[model samples]
Target: MHQLRTRPARRLVQLYAGLVLYGLSMALLVRSGLGVMPWDVLHQGLARQLGWSLGTVTIVVGALVLLAWVPLRERPGLGTVSNVVVIGLALDAALAVLPEPSALPIRVALVPLAIGLNAVATAAYIGVHLGPGPRDGLMTGLVRRSGRSVRLVRTSIEVAVVALGWLLGGTLGVATVLYALAIGPLVHALLPRLSVEVPAARAVQPVS
Candidate 1:
């Protein structure tokens, strides 16, 4: 039997690499003791509720979201598919490797760090020409079926999650705003150059 070879665009490869790097940066962000992404805030809440490691919660959530992608029949392409596992795995490992930060100064520093990491992650993620993240996928599917704009759907979801996570004792701070405002442009700027291939179809846009 002969093995078939598949060649992906260079840009896709760059995005894949970016995803892994972003995962690493996220681990540091969490460890920095500043704050976390809203989704991660939920993960922390779920971790406490379920009595599991944050990493375990990440894996569970990511897996559940990835499963939803099946129905969309959206082509994840190579980079997006890799993102599902790589981000989760790298996040878990990075958490273990990175020490939790001490003092308010370190935490403050982490805000920028997390922001930068997210930008890189977004850049890589978008580059894949694959489907969006599980959460993003949900929003896109909803919009396509219901004729709602993805922006509204995504904002609603992010607000709800952040609120819930905050109520559940997740830290909400400057980092949250940074994640919201900075990540988009950075990713937009970086994505085009990272990979040579563009998706034939548009994927759900990333929310900063």
Candidate 2:
């Protein structure tokens, strides 16, 4: 009990770190100017509307999405709620620190590094076991409730978000495609090595 209570704060730290790395990767990806991922597109769109940094927009979006979680009656794991807050803070910090690329040559050079960082971000993502992001969570929940195939549900959600972001002047390019293709595999690959299970008992259990 005592331990579980502490887990959320601890997880917040870990999530903050993860979001920092994720945000850094995203900034690099954006620098490449190749395209942005679905979430990034949305962040960029919101940033434009609000006249804020993309990172700030990220936090705002994440917070808003978290509001939906309360209604779903999904068990709000320590990681899940922490992720809702920390990702945005970390993203804001990372974006402020990482400057935009100044030239096409530099931008092109950032692609591979961006890809690798993105993979690292994926591991960080699942490490917390907070279920999916807000958008993903909504789609997944709908699929489960409706007994629809995950493929169709996921595709529809992705298409809708991408389309909406695009209409809002979000960047869409090779990087977006790259993120769609690569992030999943990277997460699958790294999950085994990086994951940590939550302690079964909050307090240290007595030895039998």
Candidate 3:
């Protein structure tokens, strides 16, 4: 809705690049050995429980979330399906390379970088306007269908998710709190700057 990064190819590049960055950020946050994003907490828990890689769990969960969209009558766009695939592969790839530091200070340092990068990634993907992440779609759908405020719907879902994740042995720490408080503001600030205006559909002209 802002500046036109009008080239379709560029938008495609942005979409995939943003997705990769988003996955890398998630991996970094998890490696910090602190809390992760709300949905990722569940992913991590399931990963541990099922003896699967975190990225594998993430993809499965994403698919299931997409399935939930059916009841809400929400359609999956190219970005949505790509979000389910590219991010998981990218996450696992990053996790393979990122270290698990036992030292507190090193782990602590990753927090800001991970969170900031995640925000940038989120903005980049969302700015292209192809579609929302599955979790985001779920929240928006619930808000529309239930007549609840976005705040209420999002918070309720996150709280429940976090609770389940914690019970299932996922980490929950200050980083989780930091992510919750900061992400919305970060995305809000960055989206406009990153946004690539979509070209309007061309109108049909009458035959001469």
| Backbone clash count for every predicted candidate, in the order shown | 4, 0, 0
Please, what are the lDDT tens digits per residue for candidate 2 over residues 51-112? 98787787777777667656665444444555566666766766667788778888877877
Residue 47 of model 3 has an lDDT of: 86
Pull out the clashing pairs in model 1.
Answer: 11-194, 11-195, 11-196, 76-130
For each candidate in turn, the TM-score is: 0.81, 0.82, 0.92
Residues 52-157 of candidate 3 have per-residue lDDT tens digits of: 9989989999999999999998766677888999999999999999879999999999999999999999988887777788888888888889999989999999
RMSD, each candidate, Å?
3.8, 5.1, 5.9
Local error of candidate 3 at residue 194 (angstroms): 0.7
Which residue runs of candidate 3 sit more than 4 Å off their true CA positions?
A: 1-6, 199-208
lDDT of each: 0.68, 0.67, 0.85
lDDT of 3: 0.85
**What residue pairs clash in candidate 2, if any at all?**
none
The per-residue C-alpha lDDT of model 3 at residue 109 equals 93
Prediction 2 global C-alpha lDDT: 0.67
TM-score of 3: 0.92
Quote the lDDT for 21 in model 2: 76
Locate the minimum summed-lDDT window of 10 residues in model 1: 1-10
What is candidate 1's lDDT per residue for 4-108, written digit by digit as tens?
Answer: 022344545655677778778777667766667768777777777788877777777877776776786543444445666778778888887787767778878
Candidates 2 and 3 compared by TM-score, better number: 3
